[model samples]
Structures are given as C-alpha cells and as structure tokens.
Target: MTKKRALGFGYLPQESKHHFLLVTPRSPNEDVAVYERFDWDESENQETGIVEDNLRVTLDRHKWNSIKDFLTTSFNNRLKENDVTVGRFKIGHVPIERLLGKEMVLLMWAIEDSDPQLISTAIKNWSGLSREERWWLFTMANAITGHADDKRGWRKAIRFALTENPIDDEDKSQVNMFEMFYKNVK
Candidate 1:
C-alpha cells in the first residue's frame, strides 16, 4: 500500500507524489527565478536527474523577501508535520510539501507582472486568504493557464485581483475569492 501523507486543500488523497520548485538566484541574489517540474513517468527515471521545468516566475530580491517569511514558516510547519527535518532553502530545487506547491504557484502567478513596490500588498492579500480559498484560486488558474509561461486569462486575472485590488484585512474575511477572480476575468 502506498503511504498516505498529509495534504493541503483541494488535493486528492491518492496524490502523494512530491513536486519540486526550482529556485535559481542570480549573482548577489538580486533577481531570483522559480520553476516547477512534475515527473509523469517516475519508473522510467534511471540515473540522470535532469527534467524539463516550466518557468513559473522571476522575482527581484525585494519582492522575494515579501513572501519568503511566509513560505518559510508555512513550509517548515508542513515538513514538521510529515516528520521531516526543516531546512533552509539553498540555491536549488526545493521539494514542495503537498499542496504548498499550489499555494506558491498561485501567489507567484498573481505577482509575476505586478509592480515590485506592490508585492507587500499582494502578500498581505494573499496571506489573508484561507488555504481552501488559495487552493480554489490555484485550481482555476491552473485549469486555464497552468503553464508557467502563459501570461493571459486566469493568470492575468489573478494578478489584477491580488495586486491591483487591495483588500483590507477586515473585508478579506467576508470577501469571496472566486467572486474577486471572476470580476477580474469579466
């Protein structure tokens, strides 16, 4: 029997394979590029770890900082839950825990083309969202524009809703993310 692992929202119980996000930081670590790769044929892999990855998004150091703390805290918490040792993210591929990959990708899609100055705002709005809400947003985004390179449709809508429209913390509690997303799309 396959071992069942704790998963995040919107994930099927049977989907337990790990997805990795590759983070490549330029010299001086000014600009960072993040990529996601999913392996379809695990059994075919023999020796080489090489795999094709989609370029999700690139973040400047400032923008990366805005979300780093949140990712670190939440990711580490997830690792602890799975009885894995939490470690710092070096300049390489980081194994995303369960559905955290979805959350990270969704957030990145929202701020990929946004103004760097507004990243804090995006992070604030993103952090206010419940995990289920984030998962739903990710699902919709992935359904239409899951590819890292795709910048239109749901990807654009996510950016518009998350960065351009700032939701106050109090209002966020009552706000429906789906409605917000649809408003942007429409």
Candidate 2:
C-alpha cells in the first residue's frame, strides 16, 4: 500500500490562548497606524466581567410600588427645577415619568462620578411616587434617559412595556397602562 501523506497539521503551530488585539486605524492620510494589543490569560471572573454591573435593577412586586412613587416624585422635582413649560398657558406640567428616568440616569452617573449632593437631591425628589408607580416610571425613565430622540425613546418605551419580561405580577399588570393613559388623554 502507498504511504498516506499526513494532512496540513505541520503547516502552522498551534495558536496561543488569551491573545487579543484591539486596533484603531489612523486617518486615511497617515501611512502607519498605532495599535494597542493585550495578551494575557483572563481569570474566570475577568472573562465573566462582573455581570451584575450590566444587570438592570430588579424590582419585585413588593418593592415595585414604593420604587415607582420615588421616581414619580423625582421626575416632578426635576421638571420644576428645569422650568419646562408644557400646557397652553406655558405653565410647567410635570413630566414625572420622563423626569424619573432622567433623574435616575443622572443619579447613576453622578454616583459614578462621586457627586454625593446630586445623588441626595435625586433621592429626596424620588420619594414622592407610590412604589408601583415608581416601578412603572422607571421603565419610562429608562427609555427617555437612554437615547436623545424623545419620540423614538417614547416609542421604544412603549414597545418595551409590551415585550420584555416584567419583574412581577404587578409589573405585568402595568403593561397596557401607558396605552390606556394616552388613550384617555387623547
């Protein structure tokens, strides 16, 4: 029988683990681009990378109402502080739902930036709504505080209410609440 040639195994050495390169290309006019590369075995936790940091706060049924109340108050306070006039008279109408999300995001960023006073203001303002209201408000708040486009954000918020799994039975009940609120207003 003719001796069979070993396949392509000998062509290249085994690739090393934990080797990752992140590269940014220089402008088109530039001939050489600078690149930074990292090569180190990541630990299990590093690989996982603190999943909790990415997790949205979980508001169960018992906590839902209280949280909602707090957000409502915060939102109202922010509206007042900003002096945003809404109605026919140009008097400020509290966009409580909108404010809640903005305040929360601001507060979160403030905490990250080590601004204790802002955090305290947010907390104090947030203490107004009932827990259930606050929970619903948070979902609304996330939409507004997320992207800059208000109309797009509102639509997204409505979609999220219709789709994403809610924290509890109470949350599930609030799914159609936005639609109802808008319908009644119109």
Candidate 3:
C-alpha cells in the first residue's frame, strides 16, 4: 500500500480544540495582503516540531454565519480602510446549497503562491472539467472541512484534501453541489 500524501496548504492551528487560521490583512495601505491563508496539515506539522503555539479559530455548528460575517467584514473593511478599489476577500461560511463565495473558494483563490496560469486556467476551465474531477475537488473540500471531530483526524482530513483525489462512490450528489457552485462562481 502506498502512503497517502496530504496536499493543499498547511499551517499551524491554535492550541484550542477548535481553531482556524485567521487571514489577516498586511496593512492599512493596501488590499493586496502579504499574507493570504494559513496552511493546515497537522501530521507533518508535528514531525516538523510545530505542534505548539499555533492557532486558528474553529466554530461550532452555530457560529458559522457570525464568524463568516466577521471575516468578510474584516477583509472588506481593511480594503476600505486602505482605499483599495478592487480585490476583496469576502470569505465566510457557505451554506451547502449556495455554491461559491465561501471560505473554500476564497482559500483556493488566495493561494498566492500557486502558478497564476494554473490557478486562472483551472478556474476558467472549471466548468469544463469532467464530472469526476469536479467531484474530486468537492469531495476534497468536504473531506477538508467535514471530517472527524478530533485534531488528528482533522489534520489527516486536511492532508488528504490537499494531497489526494477525493473522488469515490460515496456522496456523488453532494459532490455535484461543488460542481454547480463552481460553474456559477464567475
């Protein structure tokens, strides 16, 4: 059996049981931030000696909307404060039915380090992707966010989402939610 390589970006999470990386604006002068999103892969994290003093916020089932509002406002307000006319990070918790305009999409977009052509081409051609590829991406998103309740399981899920193909026989319809969402994103 081959070892599964977790992919996507990984950052250190906060010490609390529920933590998420806060994507903070760099300064009051710019909308283009020096920081985008934090990476969250916990397995290699421990191996690299990053198990402590790291944090991101996590919300219970109830706090999703509120936190989403806060993050969106934070991203928006910082831009306004800096007098930026474009480039907004209106990120928030997305309802399963709504499609894009959620943290998932924002995170994918905020990958400032990925190949620009890759990102742009991928996004542009999103609707053109095969059903299986779209399903894999959505399943990856679900796997990243909706996995086991513990930190380890959470980390593992994060790794899997980043590194592997999420396609499987389970939840094909749910996966299509992402497909519909991505097609409507632009």
Candidate 4:
C-alpha cells in the first residue's frame, strides 16, 4: 500500500518511510513496479541491484537508515536524495551516485571496528591515522569507487570529509575542515 517514488537507482516506496527501496536496475526511471504482484522482500531488492551487479551499495536496512542520518548530521552532506541525474553532486569530479555506493564499501573496510557511524567515529578513524595510512585508505577506497580523473583519489576522501559551508565564520582558518578534524583527532 505504499506509493513508489523515484530515487535514482531505485524507487523509494514511500518518502515518509525511508528505510528501504525497490530497485529497477534494467529500467531505472520507469514505473516498473518491481514489487507489483509479489510480496516485498529486502533480499529480492538487493539481488536485483547490489549482489548481481556490484554497482550499487548494499547495507542492512537499519544500517542504511543510520548512514543517511549520519551523513546529514556529521558531514552536513547527503547521498543525493534525488537520483534522477547520474551524478547530481560531484565528489572529486566523479558522480556521487556512482562513487558513493562503492566508496561506502571501502569505508566499511577502513573502519572495520566501527560501522562507519559517520560522525566523530569516522572522522577519528581517518584523522587519527597517518597520512600514509590515509593515503592507503584513499587508494583502496578510490579503487572501489571507480578511479577518478587525473588521479584525484585523495580529493574524493577529502571531499567526503567536506562540510556544507566552508565560510561559516569571519576567520578563514575556521573554514578549513581537515585541520579542524586533525585537531579534534589529536
């Protein structure tokens, strides 16, 4: 009894309930009604998109919800709610939709101890590590996130660490986010 709303790679059954979605891989934007006659199942949704293709990001429903909230609260960024355009917002010159799905997988490995809580934990995990370590994380993350142009892998992670507003205060120092996290990490 839920209304399907187009959400890029899939259809979010109801905007009010952002838990899970029914994906239409073959025809992304059409009203495919993938779950029309059948009972809705999360595994089925995953099979149609994530498992088979390895092109989409697949996480437990609960984890996915947490990821959304974490992205909004911690980074003040979103995973591009509207998936109509392939890469609505660019992350290191790569489309967010395409890059994020895989980057998330890499992020998981980076913070294996943490489920990428996406707040202080993720920042701590990244900042606490050495530049060489961060570089390793970046290279690995980029490999999964579909290598960016001009070897901008580092920029992808840095961009992921970006905030909504850089110039929030009078002082320019306050705008640089990596230093802020680096200070907090130490």
Best by TM-score: 1
List TM-score per model, in order: 0.69, 0.22, 0.24, 0.29
Model 3's TM-score against the true structure: 0.24
lDDT at 76, model 3: 43
TM-score, candidate number 1: 0.69
lDDT score for residue 160 of model 2: 38
Against the unseen true structure, what C-alpha lDDT does each candidate score?
Answer: 0.65, 0.31, 0.32, 0.34
Query: Please, what are the lDDT tens digits per residue for candidate 3 over residues 1-186?
Result: 332221111111332222233333334333221112224344543224222333222332222322334445543443344443223232321111111223333333222223333333333333234445544554454455432232344344433333232333343221344775788996
Identify the superior model by lDDT, candidate 3 or candidate 4.
Answer: 4
lDDT of 4 by residue, 50-154 (tens): 222222232334333334344333222332333232212111111122223333434433332233444344444433444455445545654555222222354
Q: Write the per-residue lDDT of candidate 2 for residues 1-186, one digit (tens) a residue.
A: 332221111111123221111111233232111111122233433233323222322222222222334544544444445443211101111111222333343323222222233333334333333555545654564444432223244434433333331323433243345666798999
- How much does candidate 2 score in TM-score? 0.22
Looking at model 4, residue 89 earns an lDDT score of 15
**Residue pairs with clashing backbones, model 4:** 8-83
Give Cα distance to truth, residue 157, candidate 1, Å. Answer: 1.1
The local lDDT score (0 to 100) that residue 29 gets in candidate 4 is 32
- Write one digit per residue (lDDT tens) for candidate 1, span 27-67: 65666665454542345541144343455566666666777
